[model samples]
Target: MALLQNLPYVPDTVRGRTVGRSFQAVFLMVLVSVLLVGAFGLRLFQLQVVEGDRNRQLADTNRIRLVPKRPARGTIFDRNGKILAGSRLSHTVSIWPIALPRDKWPMVINRLSKVLNVPPDEIQKRLEQAGYESIESITIARGISPAQATALAEYTNELPGVRLEAEAVRNYPNGDLAAHVIGYTGELTDEQLKARREQGYRLGDVVGQMGAESAFESTLHGTWGGQQVEVDSAGRIISILGDKPAIAGKDIQLTIDIELQRAAEAALGNREGAIVAIDPRSGAVLAMASWPTYDPNIFTTRITEAQWRQLQGADHPFLNRSLQAFPPASTFKIVTTSAAIESGKYDPGTVLPTYPYIQVGGIQFGDWNRAGFGPLSFPGAMAWSSDTFFYQVAMRIGGPTLIEMTRRYGFGRKTGIELGAEESAGLVPDEAWKQKNLDEDWVIGDSINMSIGQGFMQATPLQVANMFAVPANNGYRVTPHLLKDNEEHRNWKESLELSDATIDVLHQGLRRVITGGTGQSLNVPHLPPLSGKSGTAEAPPGLSHAWFGAYAPMEKPEVVVVAFAEHSGGGGGKVAAPMVLKVLEAYFKADQNAAAAAP
Candidate 1:
């Protein structure tokens, strides 16, 4: 009763308000704690479950990488299995810029420069390149010496990035002998990388740049292999995770006879032109030589800019003139003669009117030496290479027949040889071609000019050789081939239909040219009789470009050879014919040597 009277000063509402405040405070604290616990649980779940695999994969990628291991390049051999291009293991020095301390760069360069015999400034500049990656900082120097490699490895503790690596480099044993045919290889450029992206080649890869090397790049390059290496935190390789072994490239065997190639090259005797010889039956190119050549070995490793510029500036040294287009001069008369016989327009005994000069359409075309064999037969016309005689016949046969005949003889088209760049298709102007290109009308003068292999008529040395080969091969025109072993090139034969009488007459005439006429100088002394024709094409007020096309042993043909000398100014009999004779002598001598050595 006393306690109730004292409490009468405060209201029950105040007491109830105090109780509500206590409950509200407790509820607010509990809600805040629950929310904090849920947020912490979500963060832990994200770190351990949601993003765990992705982070783990990133870490693994950082700890390991695949590195390439180079495979051996294929070997190249001649028909006799003589090694022409081979490979050797060479050591090279490399650097990783990012791995080296910035302050130690100058010291490292100075040491490397002295050891490698390279200019210190060059080494320093390479190391200073900010864009260069750790893997590709060091440029190649002269091939590493044994002492230099030992010194580099010994100083590994001092030079962080410096290391020695073994690499295979292409070597040409014969130097410049078969430079054009053997070709060269070098490190791939950025443009080459872009071009070869589909080929699976990277920036540092090496690739063929010319000749047989380029023709068979895929087969020559082989397969690149690599190993996945597990590395520590410091990027030091701990172990090889797995490896894919490299597959070596297949060996290539060329149909070229090295001895004959050398002989052919020597016979040219510092002349600027080309020589091509082929086995008539097999179409295997025995020798194909382009003069003013370069040393392929210079490009095998790394060619200096100066050396490369010298080669590029050389006098058409890179020009494979054997397969290039040029006026066939009088040599193409054989084709005209063959066409005449095939058309039954004239027989060998048919006499044609001839003179020093023949006027047609206000243009008078004259014969060589301004002298003609008067009232000549077909054989006499060919022997003298009479322009007037052939002109009359060409006009009678018409241009279409001549064009068809030339095309049948492998003119106005590629020779289909394995050479990467061949220029067999020369101009065989007709009405359409003349109107489209020359913007003029075709006239009798043009036809007359075409008859003598002039005025827009042209042929490659290879085409001329092929033209001559038809008669030697008995009208079976086999497409000339440089690679006889390639499985992909099995179907390259074409049959040229011609009568035996035509071949006999033409052969007899060609034999006389070598024996007593224009090509007399081409006769081999005390050897089998060789048949050939001389050609001296006019070139803008110059003497002439000398040319000779021949096939040996008139009775039975074994090889067909053609030689052309550009801007020689001498007659084919004087320059090209003599060279062809020397080549024939060497070829027969080598053949005899081989026969003597045969088991």
Candidate 2:
């Protein structure tokens, strides 16, 4: 090595040092190579073993999706199986926003707007409402027509991720016919969602807003179903991993006789009034009608603000006058009659002098007839609706007795109909109620007014029908309902503490009302024997309200019908009795035809 260093290329011991340095460099390089390989192995183990499950889940999330499917709502039918409300198959347009480039949305939406016959601004509005970071498909249009759906299908190749989804839309065949009873459906409000969130009511859920629809929401709104799908990066479905079929809602049948309902509505005839007819034996409502009504079908489509405002007219078309309370007029005399007989303070033989006017608290309350029917008994007094006669009877029996009897007959309270919040518990004034609400003391005049169904006393047409229903049903106060043969109503009636004598007196008095009294207009010879009472009530600031309540086939009464005409100029004998006659004719025409054919 020394001789080699001394050569021209090397110095003394440089060759030895250079050889040592070369070996050190080789060793150092090998050590570094081992360290690098070990580090890489450790990192590879962590990535493949420690966090592998989490990374796999993250990868799956990018391609897997859950799509919800809505179930069909229940159908509503009349007692005769006529479809009142039903559901129709409809399509909704949806889009997987991420499937198409954001920049291309304007062009796609524009073309879709033409096919949908909707404004482009509306589509853009819906998309913006869906937020930019939404992972699920967004709804572009709901309840689209089949023609529009077909047109969209033709352009699906150009529209990328746009597609059609199946849905159920509510449909009311008869436009305005039982609008109050059937009610309407609308989107779930934020408050409703908050209240029903845990019950699986989602943000976009449709719910019943009023009437029987609201009362039976859970029974009508069916369960939701969903599918788990696997998709590619462009949001294209690769396969459906799992799917669940939705459960359909059950059908509901109402007790309404469509024929009777039509007749009742026709009889009402644009009057701001209500008519109710019920089967006294079963308490099944045969017909209920209110005028100034709206087309519930308008709610099925997108209702404009103007149309909605128009529905809330001054007369209040939405007001179910059958369920709403008003001055009951002479119809309320039935309550006083019950009180008089039940209290044992008065009898059918009890006679009182009825005058043209009665003096009470220095106020002269006049009778409808200028010359009162002279010294009439209870039967005669009730027949003529002698306000002065009842005034004396009410004072003798006391106001407490009348108020108590009113409640017993289902007055001053809701009739428990399935119409829900649409019902009004009408005002029944007494000493305590007057003191508390009106800040006035109850006096003899108040009792006199109460006897006549005037002065703060109010009642619904349903309650009036029920009042007559009690006597027609032979002392059992039935709970009126719209469900046909409802098991719940089997034991719904309460047996009153009335005696046979009281029922007889009631029948006798009501019969006299039709035979020769104020309601003689309804006492046609060709028709079955009828018992009824006609009333003319004083309503200040407007004309008196006309009221008539009647039940036919006096021996075994089957039906009770009540008619009311608000602010009608004429008396009940002339105005409301005719309406009742029309409905009764419609109801009995079928029976008459059957009898005629039987001969």
What is each predicted model's overall lDDT from 0 to 1?
0.78, 0.83
What TM-score against the true fold does each predicted structure earn?
0.85, 0.87
By lDDT, the best candidate is 2
Writing each residue's lDDT as its tens digit, candidate 2 over 366-408 gives 8778678899887888888888888888888888888898888
lDDT of 1 by residue, 77-146 (tens): 9988998788877786666555545776788778877777777886675565433334332444535667
Which residue pairs in candidate 1 collide?
none
How many clashes in candidate 1? Answer: 0
Return the lDDT, model 2, position 107: 90
Off by over 4 Å in 2: 1-51, 95-141, 146-162, 485-489, 592-599
